[model samples]
Target: MVGGVKEEYQAAQELLTCMGANVVYCGPVGSGQAAKICNNMLLAIGMIGTAETMNLGLRLGLDPKLLAQILNMSSGRCWSSEVYNPVPGVMEGVPSANNYQGGFGTTLMAKDLGLAQSTATDTKTPVPLGALAHQIYRVMCARGYANKDFSSVFQFLREEEGQ
Candidate 1:
């Protein structure tokens, strides 16, 4: 009765949970979704902050490549700076080099952040970073790069700075 196929989504989710299948990678309202939502929020915020930091570097006359190199070697570096530097010509491994191709799509990121924000609102949890991440993602979609890698947020920053 509880595992009816009509709404098999939640029913299967519960059955798996009861069976100790905590490491699931898909389906609705599972741990995977939770992890995805949380990490996307973190990733989005990281991209935003990385963009701001890179903006500062450009303003200071530092070559993005040089700044990226140092950031990769230092505590200031993160996944965005080291593995996914958004500035073209700064990093070789990121999708940004090929016009921001590959990596997580921005539309999915925005959706994840929006989901997290809604969950936070329902739970009365304050997630300012998540909210800001959601808004920035909206801008990315508005700018027509929502299909690019989430790291494409750097492009948004560069545009905002009048460069």
Candidate 2:
């Protein structure tokens, strides 16, 4: 995403497009950052929701793969469920399948959520879910998951089950 004076953005748009980048002029300065913060907040919330749902489904004897498929085909479908499912063995070539390594780290997610929290507070927006997601990521970072993929929230929830 690009954010700046409209003319500047328009000037760079063609070059960005030529580089095979999907560029969008969000608006004036700082708008791109705002958009990114909002997007990441939603992404974090979605991942956590997917993790919780997968865990509950497993506890209820539903197959992870089947549950994911059902969710994908239903109104529950989301990027988290369809593209970056948090359940191991539910999808291949994702951080979950590879043991939650080499993807977006929990620490990074926590930082982004922190920014989201600050932004929400500044804008006086009530982001209860985003705040909760921020807290969850903060706890994950403190529980030795700082280096793990954000999707490892599934593992975190599973471990919590025994505690």
Candidate 3:
């Protein structure tokens, strides 16, 4: 998403569109960063939730793909579940399928969550879940998942279980 003065954003959007970017003008200056921070914070939380749910399903003897499909068709549906499933073997072309090799790295996600946490603190906004997600990602980064895709939280969770 683009932000800042509308005219300036329009000019930038024209150039971005030339490169086939699907950009949206969010609002004033800093709005784009705000949007990204909010989005990544929620994405981190959703991915964690998805990983937890998928782990539970696996331990319950439910097939990962089938459980993912059920979630996609139900109220539990989210991008993490339907698109970037956290469970290995559930979806192809995602980091999870490739052993969490390529995609948004855990360190990057932890950084984004740090931004979100800082923003929330500065605004005096309550973000209990976001804070928890931030801590989780921070721990993930410290546990040797810094370069792995954030979806590797699934593996992180699994390892934690083993301990």
- The candidate scoring highest on lDDT is 2
Whole-model alpha-carbon lDDT for candidate 2: 0.93
List, residue by residue over 93-140, the lDDT tens digit for candidate 1: 678888888988999888999899988888899999899889989888
Model 3 scores what on Cα lDDT? 0.92
Any residue pairs clashing in model 2, and if so which? none
Off by over 4 Å in 1: 1-29
Poorly placed runs, candidate 3 (over 4 Å): 18-20
Q: What is the C-alpha lDDT of each candidate?
A: 0.81, 0.93, 0.92
Instruction: TM-score for candidate 1, please give it.
Output: 0.79
In terms of lDDT, the poorest run of 10 residues in model 1 is: 1-10
- Which residue pairs overlap in candidate 3's backbone? none
* TM-score of each predicted structure versus truth: 0.79, 0.95, 0.96
Compute the lDDT for candidate 1: 0.81
Arrange candidates, best TM-score first: 3, 2, 1
Each model's total of backbone clashes: 0, 0, 0
